[model samples]
Target: MANSPQSKKRARQAVRRNDVNKARRSRIRTYLRKVEEAIASGDKAVAQDALKNAQPELMRGVTKGVVHKNTAARKISRLAARVKALG
Candidate 1:
């Protein structure tokens, strides 16, 4: 439905951005799942390490606009608390 040339270009850009954002979101979820599995397995050391690795990935998601800043903060906070409680 993009009749204008500009609109066509915009549509193309949107598709590319959507694909990139989807990949980034999937990657972030994989990292979070790693942390969750580690936590569920009751291994504090592995959970701590997974959380450590996930922090940068989550922050990257925020910086790339795939995730909200406050949402990232809340997620990291809760995950850290859960990891800590595994003590």
Candidate 2:
């Protein structure tokens, strides 16, 4: 029900943004899942590497507005702790 031209344009923009954000979120999740799988496999080295890779992706998500800053920080902190404990 976007009667106004501006509203219609906004709706279109929203759809585009939704697609981009969805892809970004999915990519971030893939990175996190890699770390989790490595951790589950009990491979400390691989887990550490995956964690290192995922940390930046998560932070990038925060910067891109795809994720909340505190949420990203908490996730990274907890994952780091888990990686450290794998020793």
Candidate 3:
């Protein structure tokens, strides 16, 4: 119910942004899942590499406003700990 032209434009922009954000979120989740699977497989080396790859993606999510800074930090911290414990 965007009656005003500005509102309609905003709605359109929001829809576009939503799609982009959704794609970014999905990609981030995929990276996180890779780390989880690597960890689950009990290969410390693979898990370490996966975590290394995922760290930047998670941080990118935070920078892109798809995730909070502390949330990204916590996830990276926990994943790093788990990977380390695989030793």
Off by over 4 Å in 3: none
TM-score order, best first, reads 1, 3, 2
Report lDDT (CA) for all predictions: 0.98, 0.96, 0.97
Those runs of model 2 whose alpha carbons end farther than 4 Å from true positions after fitting are none
TM-score of each: 0.98, 0.98, 0.98
Tens-digit lDDT track of model 3 for 1-87: 999999999999999999999999999999999999999999999999999999999999999999999999999999999999999
Where model 1 places Cα greater than 4 Å from the true spot, the runs are none
lDDT score at residue 52, model 3, on the 0-100 scale: 93
Clashes of each: 0, 0, 0
RMSD of 1: 0.5
lDDT of 2: 0.96
Report the Cα lDDT for residue 59, model 3.
96
